[model samples]
Target: MSQYGKLMLDRYPEKMILPESSVIMASDGTVLRRIPLPETGYRIKAGLGEMPQLLIDTFIAVEDRRFYSHKGLDYQGIARALVNNTVRMGVSEGGSSITQQLARGLYLNRGQNLLRKLNEASIALTLEKQLSKDEILQLYLNQIYMGQGQYGVKSAAERYFGITDMKHLEIGQIATLAAIPKGPSIYNPVDNLELSAGRRDLVLRIMQQHKLITTEQMRAAMKGPYIPPVKDKTEIVGASYMDAAIKEAMRQTGLSRKELCAGGYTLVTGMNIEAQRAMERAFSQEEAFPPDGKNQRAEAAMVIMDQRNGEVAALLGGRNPSTGGLNRAVTPSRQPGSALKPIIDYGPALESGKYTPDSLLPDIKTTYGSYSPANLNGVYRGQVSMRVALQQSINAPAVWLLKQVGVSYARGFAVRLGMELAAEDNHLAIALGGLHSGVSPLMMAQAYTVFANGGILNKAYLVRSIRNSQNQVVYSHVAAPQQAISVRTAADMTAMLRQAVSEGTGRRARMDVTVAGKTGTTQLDLPGVPGKANRDLWFVGYTPRWTAAVWMGFDHSDPDNYMTAGSGFAAAMFSKVLSML
Candidate 1:
């Protein structure tokens, strides 16, 4: 062998193997779904034993007849193809064998030129030398492209006939799948059924001619009914949860979606199925939301995190969301309203060592540098306690407390708690949840974990671990809790928020179990409107075991499309989810 051939043989094994689809499982080891390969769609590897004998026989008989006798390059078949093309005055016959086809699919593109064909031949010769006959055939079967974005016979079987095991396939179905590799687009059973059936009959006839199957078998298979391909419904359950898990897996592994899909990794997520279903049920109820306005329907998003390890338990981006559509739960597009008070205003004030729950904060009209913040009720009591100020969600006191705590210092503190505040947010308006960019429900839930987790901020995550196809642990999550506030401060903040839920703005969220939460609403400024019209409503809260953030609004809030309800609506929805849990 040449030195170059030896070098090529050393590198062939890594390149010859095909990518397999990654699987995603829930926390309890329940299989959630399989992520499809990047451009190739879905693929599942099949061993030689998993493939039916009929499929193997039909594929070999139609694709390569002299497979057992020929070396990598079939000189006799090549000569015959050349003569036949010359007689036809066109390229109608392919001289490349199954090994050459595999090499081209794996290492080279399908270009009908001498250079590409030469490269294919060299690689095929190397593959034949390196792998045994069955190995070569197994790789060919698993690596070949079938149709409809499927990569192998297994994926095509599951896709075209909805059959997981090849043994369940009829003889005609096996022939149809075997016929697709010749021209996947032309013989696709889903798109061109008549053409695929004709090709399947040709394969059956070829199998009979090779004496691989009897004449009676061939006739019966040809006369069988050809069912059109059905859409695979394996991903119908937990589609949105799977999408979010995939995104988190990509982020944690530093792998792109394509890489994660093709890596064959098993991602174990922290998804709580019961909590997910409860959140879904709450969001699906039309009565849970306010009546739709003339122009738009209200939308809502929620995120629930397990406080034990900061793993996201349940998430709902919106009602009836498309699988990969806009995920509002993770996108920080809407203003958080008074939800920012606990993280920025009160929490920071308590941590500053200068304030307490009973500290008398001035609720009188206050103005600083042309910025005059007002209470939502347009009435303020002078010298209200800090606890009452937070419970009523009085805006003036929050802004005043932020002024005392210093905007820069409070913003820095909120950052440590997982709120992504902007440079422009270094102002008193943040006390009222006014900002250049808003926070996502995910960010809100993560921030609230500080209070639920005894002053330690546990970052929320979805994936707990990932294992590669070889059953090797590739990535595992480690709990890293950052101290954002003192235990006393967290307890004080929780006390105030608990009162808020029991008697104040978040009273609608009170449950049988111990719950602490706050409510927030961003008012819409519309001239001639009687009362307050809200653009955004929010309720951020936590229990002993879980932290949750809920937001309600329209995607685009305008005069015609705005919220008429207050944050109590969001709090009530939260109560519904908690009840189900």
Candidate 2:
């Protein structure tokens, strides 16, 4: 028996079970929201000493009359239940003691079979040898399921009766709570009040018969007024931000969603509520976007991050956002157009020690194999400096420079800046963002951090720290900055991008603070289409303090559903969001 007890104790989990919810908080310690476990609703723990005397006595009388006297199982109670159930011709009574019930709940599933019953009895004996009677009772009261998705007595009391303190509960309310664990669904107070009240009266009679309560006390308790459950009114603000934070936390801690939901953790995130609300408001205004036809609306996503430490301040997955929906801010579906020019073309060329901002390159129409690249306007300068070529976002010179730098070397440089490229992305079309799979707005923002942070890439993250239920720090963020390019390369790229924003194609994104950015537009090719219709528009920009990437397009690109205003509209939206910050 002793050896079996030791083996069971060794196999027990360090932390027995996960709690109800994980609290997500902002950096300033303001609670953003509580993410509840899907299986169990909400649980607030109450120790055995905190329970009222009437509640305890009633539970003991109704659940297990020999609870204190029995070691783990009550033979007399089991014999009586077997005889009664045999007489009734069905299994209607449970002969398990309180300790046995606790063991079953903690270790075994609710399967009605002889093998499971034997296993439950063995575990019950092991628990009795290891734990005191008070310890077993406390665990049972805190883990037993009540009705309405509540787990423990404290959660049930506060949820059903709005009583936070268990001692403040009325006699009838206490009896009602104690009667729920038998069959929570059948006797749920909120769903079936009369049935729950009848169960409460049965508990009162049992307490009286056990001499735990007087007849007058039981009668008065049964005659009390019935109270209904109050509705929970906690509003979930910033669904998109919450969704991103949950994903990031899971990635950082290597825990699954179910584990995080039940771990009772405090996830401190870098979300700025004011900035999140401002971005949501900006996306809410329809006039800020291009005039898509009445039947279809253009979709957009934006991500903002602190360039200093890579903390994601605010994010918008889409115009009409829903949690766990297609998060376009992090989903890479559309091409980036000329946004790849700065990172893959100019930055890598300058980092090679063979090119500078003033290095001359050809901008005329050219072809390598069957692929020929052209400027957006079908006009180009013969030989322009690299700065001039980047400011105007000339496509011919970018492809020429990528050819000169060697596609393999240039792509290697891009990979270090956080762009996920495939083997098929190995041609001159990469200079024009014609990859098999394009990059997301999150990848764009993180890649630009190299230039903003002077050649060091700060990986973007949402969660700053995570604390377990015992208030111990389980995980914290540490800076892991990698040098992706030379300091001179970052400086020259920033200077050229600033010119692009101030005087060239990105002028719509210019603001009071010194801004550096690039504009990109991918044109749609429809057979016999007269004019250039854009399928995607992108603007990736950064101030000294913040970096943001914005993308505007349709969810599905067709001849009828495309952008009419080009990347300037995306740049203008970036400016609008920047002003609010």
Candidate 3:
């Protein structure tokens, strides 16, 4: 190799350059996802020619006073910085010209060492020779980080000020953000109000000293209250949910994460932005679970589906969808309690050709060996129709009806409805939601969706479609509904469930819209806390438009925690969200 080539090879290691692909948008042409790449994180490109003159002038005034005259290095400014640092006795107290700053940000780490400084100077000089000053400055601006996870000025302006066009920012706002790159954390107006105001004043002082701003203008700017706007910080922002859905789709579809993030394509999803916002508003504003430390947090999960097509409309893994740890809506595996009774008892009876909505079942006190079941109120009303039994969720009558029908047959019926019931000797408890294996809220929502769709079961999907840079559809969730039950049985079940919403334990969940639902509460497994109570409390419900499940109970092994009867808390949130819809 040539001597210069050897030196160059030894100095900077070769790294592959990957160009970012444009983000794929939804069918509505809304950007939903993109291929993931480090360089592609929230970046948008615009040529230097398209940039506003005011923006360019702002950069020139704040970044490089001698930018137009200097080749790259501003020796006078460097010498002044050295002198200033020597006097101030602080690191980063000296001057770095715009070119040097850009070189360090784009080509080298901002380390306070001699090697990095040398490299920065070499690269800055090299870049000055190769590219026009405007081009270099535009690239620098595009790549630089402006606090708040905003990588570019455009992103920063939108995030902090909600302005889109570059020309919208006032001179003072531009100066404030221009000063922020020096120390983002300390000077962040949102984080440290006083420090940010002080730094803004300092920038104004610098501008005045350079005669960029009049003394009178500086005085006027200083008089204003530097109150920063409050960031919403709510977890359910559009960008946040879309980002998650894209990641989840990537995981489920086994697509390249990079392509999904940076490769621009159209991504259609099952999400309804309006419904999601409404659901988020309902959840964030209300207490959805019990407040006692045992069940202090009102964790809930909601899954909405398109009844006709079986697409997942909205899925909230928890009351706060942003909760980082557990996603109950998608993953919580808890016993359905009485909520399981519909599949275990009613479904089989419907399939057996022996039961109809009007069929009467003896509502007498019932027993299986030592297990004697009672109504929720500890009393029974004898000789009720099947519709009344299901609507009231009467325990003894359901147990008797299940016994008359048979558990193994009921298990098979539930399986047809998409519930994977673990093998167990089905007994009276099956009528009361006793299950060998637990089910997730998503699973429950899906199972209920069968009834909502008049026996058709469609696979739940979050993504609608994904397209590549060429706009060719690479992946799409096609709607395919399966016939799981006869239409007659489904309609009957819906009618009974609707009655449950109107007059039974799920009355708390009644909404202005037609709704159907069930309520469940198991004895706390803890001995003393509730004196032989079980561990799960639940309310699973659906409207003409949406389906949601709420589970409350202590995950603690000892279980001696306070219990939240699922009816009040979960039902309240459900009702609130339904009202908004």
Residue pairs of candidate 2 with colliding backbone atoms: none
The lDDT for every candidate, in the order shown, is 0.85, 0.85, 0.68
User: On residues 90-122, what C-alpha lDDT tens digit does candidate 1 reach at each position?
Assistant: 766769898888877887888876667777788
- Of the candidates shown, which would achieve the greatest TM-score relative to the real structure? 1
- Local accuracy of candidate 2 as per-residue lDDT tens digits, 166-209: 99988788889888988998786887888999999998888789
Question: In model 1, where do residues sit more than 4 Å from their true spots?
Answer: 1-17, 38-40, 46-62, 75-96, 103-135, 157-244, 291-294, 526-531
Could you tally the backbone clashes for each prediction? 0, 0, 27
Count backbone overlaps in model 1: 0
* lDDT comparison, 1 vs 3, better candidate: 1
Candidate 1's displacement at residue 211, Å, is 10
Tens digits of per-residue lDDT for model 3 on 229-334?
Answer: 5655644334434555667668766877665665544567777766666667766764556654543553556666666676666666665454244666666467
Q: Which regions of candidate 2 fall more than 4 Å away from where they truly are?
A: 1-20, 30-40, 43-66, 73-97, 103-130, 154-251, 254-257, 290-297, 320-323, 352-361, 383-385, 469-471, 528-531
Where's the lowest-lDDT run of ten residues in candidate 3? Answer: 13-22
lDDT of 3 at 28: 49
